[model samples]
Target: MFRVTRLAVPVLALIMAADPAVAQDPPLCAASSDTARTAAEVIAAVAEHQCPPGSRLRAAMTVAGQAVVLQRSGICAPESVRTMTIRPTPDTRALDTRALGFTCILATR
Candidate 1:
């Protein structure tokens, strides 16, 4: 029984170490405000910094707690999707990005 238990422990350790999911690193991320003046620019900067060549944009959104304004004439209008403007709220003003309020995720193709 003692010898079996000793062998089982090593076998279990080897099985767990062979898992691809356990060996993989978490996704990379980057944020920049100094060079990224617009949403497009911010996404580009983050991709350049964190993603490898041939990567594509996966998701983009404003940072939490940042105030923003969405303007549109009417819901049914063809041009109703107007613009999204980021404004500095008291809580977000002190953030490292100064409330530019842009973040992006990228994935390898």
Candidate 2:
């Protein structure tokens, strides 16, 4: 009886330890004042910084205290969507591209 009681206690704890509530809330990525700007706005902003076209821009943002990271969308010549991850940094602002493992280039096309 003593041995059975000890084992039962541990088994009960293991079963009760699992909580289903944690699965309800998942990490999310929402638009913020910074990301609130449109793709063209971000691209144009980066162009002012001399970023060349056909480049990639990665932005790490936080939403609801959760980090929502994404690459900027790119626009090709003739104004068509060629890429989904494209971010442009403004020329006037000194955004560090190295931290994102990518560099910001001007978009003339």
Candidate 3:
């Protein structure tokens, strides 16, 4: 059997609270150097978010070694959802809000 660690929830919750746009659900995690693989992995990670009750990938964008994804809810609301970054090590996988490192909540104009 497989289970999400008790740890992942809190990390994702912290990411969610970092942005009002992400408040409707917890963030998802996806990582890889390849964009296609990142999208595939991200689609798989959606369940981790417990999102929408019904949702699907509407679009994905890769920028600066990360994937910025959008999801369409069952209620038809579009969300700027999970942000996944490619890291060379698990030690670097932790999300932060700073301008200096790998962050799920990257600042965008």
Residues 1-109 of candidate 1 have per-residue lDDT tens digits of 3456768889988988999877754343444342325444444565467655222222223432221221111111222222234555666567734323332223333
lDDT, model 1: 0.39
- Most accurate candidate by lDDT: 1
lDDT of 3 at 1: 80
Q: Indicate the worst ten consecutive residues by lDDT in candidate 3.
A: 100-109
For all candidates, the clash counts are 0, 14, 0
RMSD of 3: 15.0
lDDT of each: 0.39, 0.37, 0.38
CA RMSD (A), model 2 = 15.2
Off by over 4 Å in 1: 1-4, 18-27, 32-39, 53-60, 63-90, 93-105
Top candidate by TM-score: 1
The alpha-carbon deviation from the true structure for residue 43 of candidate 2, after best TM-score superposition, in angstroms, is 2.8
- Tell me the alpha-carbon RMSD of every candidate: 10.6, 15.2, 15.0
Point out the higher-scoring one by TM-score: 1 or 2: 1
